[model samples]
Target: MAWTKYQLFLAGLMLTTGSLNTLSAKWADTFSAEGCHGDKEHEFSHPFVQAVGMFLGEFSCLLVFHLLLCHDRRRPVPTVNPGQSFNPLLFLAPAMCDMTATSIMYVALSMTSASSFQMLRGAVIIFTGLLSVAFLGRRLKPSQWAGILITILGLIVVGMADFINLSGREEHRLSDIITGDLLIIMAQVIVAVQMVLEEKFVYKHDVHPLKAVGTEGLFGFTVLSLLLIPFYFIPVGEFTGNPRNVLEDALDAFCQIGQKPLIMLALLGNTVSIAFFNFAGISVTKEISATTRMVLDSLRTLVIWAVSLAVGWEQFMGLQVLGFLVLLSGTALYNGLHRPLLARIPCCAAWVLDDAEEQASAAERERLLANNRVVQAGDDA
Candidate 1:
């Protein structure tokens, strides 16, 4: 009935990460939309700034994690033989992928409601499954296929609902809303690609989770820095069409921060949260299972939705609610959550869980028998 300290620590990390992640979206959208630094409006719209912040934050977190590891006597898995375990050159792919995905998502956040932005990410599970089959030659169970279908349905429902809402609005641009939603979806696909590649290569390479992320963060930060050179010359939004000088928009954002103390605070919070989100995410994956991490990610979506509503950024929509339920159901089924629950139910126990249970039991029995034979051979010797 009692949890170990380690368990409590993990739970705390998850809670902190989830809350910070949800609040990051809220703060970002709020400061961008509601004005920053005491002004009634944001002087300039710059999701690029968030993109910049991401690399910096991730890099910062990486430093802290590396330092903590150094203080410990235990050797890191990937650090035992750095050249053998991890090649710095191999970090390029995921780093590029991270930059692309992070940039797109931040821009999308400015365009869509936090709830929709979060909900659209549910597409990642479906994408990951398809990617695994195509590249890894992995086969799926029947229930997993069913879950994929359900998840696809949920994606359609949510997209359609957003479209309907967009069409009903006079001021909203159909192109912008659709584009934004598409960007978010596209980012999920990239993320899925990154995950699959990491799973295949990084794990085989024995790259420690934190090390891989830190390396990627370093690469991503450098790349983003280079990209910002060109972006700095771009005009700030559509206001005066003046070309943005180096740090022009960031300067404006900071000046606005001077006016609104809370905006500055929120900005700081967003920076820290983004870092913690990455750290906690990796921890969850390593400590628990990847499937559990996926479930926790969905829980984070719920937090974003609730916070969005509480803060009056979004209204409850029946279609959105239905779509969320479908998404949740699909994720559960894909992750095999339903099997245990179905087995507990009296009627469906035989229908749904029996086959899976039988297969698991058979495989376990075979393993034990093999071990017994090995023991008997040793005794005979």
Candidate 2:
């Protein structure tokens, strides 16, 4: 089917907002804000605080959700299913998972280049697949398994490039980048758990996607916001840019934001971009195929990398480009998008067409049964 202009707009919104989410957060880290001591400016190193900003952004989703809900109530037909209601408290578990994953990712972003941070998020595909099989009793197709392996290889290549510091940039230590990469991968594990939880527990209630995001945001923000107090008192060796040298100095972060207009702007961008990104992403999945959303995500990664390089945030590395291509191919194959395109090539046409024909035979039946469940429950995964 030909794409509509609105679909194109949502795709662009997804790409732009998703890219900005990472770039703004990374950009925030580039600033030096005034510390509590007032003696000198300190580098912005508050990952926990950043997580709060992200959750706050997510909470804004609730506002739009309610506005839409009110509009829906005025319609002749009600959109909600009475029997599908779920307790709001169930979201806490996934909210915690989101909190942990987002915090670790922020910390990892601070230690690594923005491009690598964006690229490494692809790790979630691997973990989500594995976790779904283990916990959700779902089975992966052969192509999907192949995609997982190829994605792993791509991750290794990316990690190796960072490990070797192929660009030979001495600004960050080798360990920091490696640790950052490891942290990002670890965070994906938690993210996978969150996705599975959402699929199993939340989706069963037939919750609206916007309302779910907003609820999770509310839970995550409220809990993490409270934790910031203790984090301020807990001393930590790393991220010690405040007078107390604690894990996260909320006061110092606030002071820094007050002192540096750019940091505030970055945080504002981070918040606003996240809300819009999630909105655009969900809308894209609804209006188009999830495959389209994945493609847009890959494009977003490229946009982020180009921006990072243009801003001198990181040097260009050839291996990273190769790894991204491999990863992109893996995702495309997993989604069965490559079959149609590959069938055009004379050398591989026979094999690709055979697979395409096989899948097409069952496509209608599977689509009928799985359309609502998969699209509603698994898109975020």
Candidate 3:
């Protein structure tokens, strides 16, 4: 039996999605193995590694942008005037927000567990929804609001599970974990703001998404690099050569990356993955509706969590699974039902009305031309 076009398309999407997921996993593994987590002996612990990784990742993203621009040039170039080149500064906003958000998330990850990170990240969807409405003047429907509420509830469940687990652990400090959790939540808010801003200014301008991403990466790296120079100047005793602590050991180990083949591989993997994620994400947006893409993205998080648990990178708990289910359900509800229902209102209606108006205008023009010819014929007679 021959497959329908839709079926064929679905098959292709599945393959692409699977490959992207595998690539993401490989990248994460490489970083974990290469001590991208940094060494226990170094003073540069979680925050430092995160900062450095983000720097490298952004640089890699810029390279990918260059590749994308070259590819675009081979196609019919868009009619851009000489002064119409994308302003690098305007593109920097999203990149700066992303770097800040990701950096905070990384710092939080060091303080918390993988499961907590995944669960907490769900808050981003809610923030994105609200930010879209506030910043972009996009209105959300009641159903979307319902979906957001469900997602929030699910995340709360996940957080509760983390709290329970923490209570059972003698080595963990509750205060530190709470602080990290708050930081992660803040990061999600930042990410949401960044996404909304990108949609409004960058994507709306018909900027090639990859080029925009690349510029963001370039600016992010530049900003971080400058900040790090001042950071290096801060008398962090470990850099002063008193190698007695974990932070010192981590810093020392980072210095050894120049000699480690594995570290290089990990860094390369991370960079490649960053590029792939951005490219795939942008392409997917063009192929699928944002609501659908957001739903799939939530599913991807679940897949990541499952894989992490299976690989012993994370410990699975009943509550964690329940939380994941809740979060997933909420996401589905929002995308599948809420968004579609709400779209029927002012936005979709306005689009249809505009299209009808354009058709009417064309018909009127034809009618006027016909009447003009009729009048001319009468004059000749």
Could you estimate the TM-score for every candidate?
Answer: 0.79, 0.88, 0.70
Per-residue lDDT of 16 in model 3: 48
State model 1's lDDT.
0.73
Query: What's the distance in Å from true for residue 312, model 2?
Result: 0.7
Instruction: Name the candidate that leads on TM-score.
Output: 2
The digit string of per-residue lDDT tens for model 1 on 1-381 reads: 565687557656776666665467457556533333444554334565667666777778668765776665375553433334447878788788888998888777777778888888888888899999998877788888999999999988888888877776765466666877899999999998998888776665656566777778788888887776676666545432113433335555555556566765655676677677777777767666676677777887787788788978877888998889999998888888887688888998887766777778877996899689889989999
Per-residue lDDT of 45-69 in model 3, one digit per residue for the tens? 4354445554565567567666655
Q: What order do you get sorting by TM-score, best first?
A: 2, 1, 3
- lDDT against the true structure, each candidate: 0.73, 0.88, 0.63
Ranking by lDDT: 2, 1, 3
Q: For model 2, state the Cα shift of residue 338 in Å.
A: 2.2
lDDT at residue 201 of model 1 (Cα atoms): 68
Clashes of each: 3, 0, 12
Q: lDDT per residue, candidate 2, 34-73, as tens digits? A: 7766748778888989899999999999889888878878
lDDT of 3 at 136: 74
